[model samples]
Target: MSGTVSDYLLYRLNQWGVRRLYGYPGDGINGILGALGRNSEFQFIQARHEEMAAFMACAHAKFTGEPGVCLATSGPGAIHLLNGLYDAKLDHQPVVAIVGQQKSMGLGGHYQQEVDLPVLFKDVASEYTVMVSHPSAIRHAVDRALRIARAERTVTCIIIPNDVQESPYQRPPQVHGSIHSSVGYSEPRVVPKEQDLRRAAQVLNEGKKVAMLVGAGALNAADEIIEVADLLGAGVAKALLGKAVLPDELPFVTGSIGLLGTKPSWDMMMGCDTLLMVGTSFPYSEFLPPEGLARGVQIDLDGRMLAIRYPMEVPLTGDSQETLRALIPLLKRKEDRSWRDSIEKNVRQWWKVAEGQAMKEANPINPQRVVWELSPKLPDGVILAADSGSAANWFARDLKIRKGMMASLSGNLATMGCGVPYAIGAKFAYPERPVIALVGDGAMQMNGNAELVTVAKYWKEWKDPRFIILVLNNRDLNMVTWEQRVLAGDPKFPASQDLPDFPYARYAESIGLRGIRVDKPEQIARAWDEALSANRPVVLEAYVDPDVPPLPPHITLEQAKHFAEALFKGDEKAAGVVSQSIKAMVEQLKPHKS
Candidate 1:
């Protein structure tokens, strides 16, 4: 017995456990949508735009760790989905895009909506095929595409001619079930040498004040790292990406390390008698310190990464978890708790200083103040998709993500326009969690607006728990301006960088969503209440002073010098210019200082 390929495809998709699909309906692809509607378990959500459908699909894959589906019609409709699909491809996300093609009659000769979709998508997709006369091959094509998506962790494409979509048939395609999980570090495929482990053990035993620096790789060994840190009475500092994985609230834990890093984390790293580098390969060698005095012991899966920039005293190649597990017993316990307490006290002092001085001023609200205010109102276990610039830095430091909040940005791709789509994906994977897109005005205007339709689909899908868009609207590229003054040494810019200011809140309002503009400092509470109270998509556009800079909780004297040197090239004349900028910054900081 035979059935319509569309029906078989739908049945196969159900078998794969794909419940939600993002796309828009058009004349050429009506049959595919009709087939999808027959099943109550699955949904083909109509998006405002085709590109948004691809974006939503990408986001879904990121959250679910499965291949997300995007459906589209012929020609222009499918063409609009390219950029978002590229994002998924580059990010190594699994997505399957199904596009409608003109009927077989339209082939070879000129016909309306007649573009070759399979050919068009060939480069972007991991695999692609067009089904015209081959009805029997459709099931195999889809199944093959699913396997590729699952294995390669990339996008796949399937083009079905209109006639094939409406072809006569009897039985639906056979469905199959799969139980796939993250390809996380599997069995300790490799282990470290006993000598290397012993050397690290020897150094830690010898050190009086030791601190363990954790990176993303340390996530699996968090418990082990914590155990060893406790044994040595060592303070723990992590990189920004390592935030959630590490024990943040622990007494011995210091904040992150870098320019934005708080606590005396960097100092702790430099001052420690032995610096235990657990699953980290941080690049900034200047900030890393001399490997000789500190005796850096780096434990990593890719042992070559250990001390690639700087030489290491102990380079152990193995699974972070396994190596850490083995080394835990070897470490001798320290009686003194003074070192850990001192770091904790420093963190508290710094926190108080930042909180005090960083409030909105009399004339206007600071961008940092906007972030500070949003910190509390953020939904618990909410998802944050951050862009590269100052917005990410601000969120990285201030947004208290202690117990909840899922961060999509793992490494430093830090491109603009990730927030909306990232949130939508997080929402797709975790239907229960309230997904949030915390975006800055400059960043959002770049790529985020394209994904608004994805959020709209969520609103239509569920009347309650819409994607909340908290936009930090400072009306200028504040992050870039700071980079120019602080890093580039040039505060001057062309007119184009100064973007056109608009009523973003009003535009969101016009789009059938609640758009509340918070111009004054006091309006924040009311705006947040409306955002939290409402069950629909809301855009909180907080107008802030673009000139107000974002400073991390702590900065070392050397980092300050680096900024000065970068701007002025160590010229005495440039000293005046750099000093003036620093003075202005210090004035703003004074209000927050203890």
Candidate 2:
């Protein structure tokens, strides 16, 4: 369709329905850039850094159900994409990376900007990674990369040497030793066999007290999950990645399960006689029912992920929605309503405790209150992205996700610095929807601040300009600091956990976006309101207290002993920690007034 291999590459990608690309420019990719300039079909989004570009691509794939595409230069640029690619790989999102390379001839001679990119990308893009050594090879390279990425729901890489990119395109001849590829992919319909579904239904039907767990894989099967839960009289627990699989408003749905989970979820897992894990690889075995305590039935698209988290009596390998649809017909509704009623009661009580904890006093603002106020205020169809750290803790435990809204974060990688880039990517994919990013001071300092510039560059083009980034500026790596106390029985190490305070709101203002700062407890509600109503994107910076403990749902005796040890070891914030911890526990005990 064009002159150079670069032009043909873009044309091929366009044929594959890829209209947007996230990347940064470098001389190594000059050829591709030149082609992009001449082609108006592709919208090139320039990220502040290559790493952020990769993160954006991953997020795009996550939010849009398409294979996300990212481009980078050779050597350092390629290296920078690894972390974000790993985030995609670990989370099993489809993403295709197009990276530049040095001239083909100079590669083995220690050329500048040369790196063994194939080997470098081997593990992250283990499904497929190839270098285009010939002009004809570019055709098959682009084709296979995107196809594999989509089919596998994993990362794939294609390396193009500068010279090869500049060379004239060539169609593969219909001869021996030549490969020809085409542009097109349709996901196959996958439903487990009827017998397997019956077996799973039998396991679920036989148990009186059934518990269900869902993860990111179950997102598309929301209606089916609700039907299945209703039929089985099961209490559903969500993995962090699957926070939006079911609305928190469901009375029997226990919010999240893990270190940042709710008490009802822990109780459900502890007490259930049967478990039905649907499309989730919630790795924490401790949070799940102990082995042999409950008979389990697991359903996953990837068979490799089944029976690993818990020993399952039946493993159903198939698409979540289709599999659940088939299983629903075989499932018999449970007659007893007691188990469902208790779960609903606990759900109601947990919300009250969460709100009370949010209202409890802290030095400046309770982090829980920041999300709590925002929860009721979230608009329909709002897309939320949270970074890893204390912000994720609050986002996981406090925020009440509704049916229509979408939310996600770095789940398996648990990587920081993804919030802003992910929000940016979401805004690009769905320009009409409102997007919000929840991040901590540490993540903001790491890379979120720079991404504000990217946001500034593109906000004017969006259909609805209501992008918001809420930075919890606590001047500490709050999550890890608490982890030190709870997990390791060690006091806070200021050297590793302390973070320098920054004027996040002011920085947003300087970059031509609205900025709101909240320090007082009451200011949180108003700040969220103003930010949501503003004409342009706003940064709502809340100076929350780092000492407000992100207490787990059910604290173990070992965890309690460690907390005491950390305090006895002279933790820097021992006094504030003790006061806040006591208030949080006391608040949970008091009856809900509202």
Quick one: best TM-score, which candidate?
2
If scored against the real structure, what TM-score would every candidate get?
0.75, 0.99
Error of 2 at 391 (Å): 0.3
Q: C-alpha displacement of 17 in model 1, angstroms?
A: 2.4
lDDT of 2 by residue, 425-480 (tens): 99999999999999999999999999999999999999999999999999999999
- Model 1: which ten-residue window has the lowest total lDDT? 178-187
lDDT of 1 by residue, 46-146 (tens): 66677767877877876666788898898888898776687777666688888888888768777987887767888889455545455665666677677
- Find the candidate with the highest lDDT and give its number: 2
lDDT of 2 at 377: 96
Relative to the true structure, how large is the alpha-carbon lDDT of every model? 0.69, 0.94
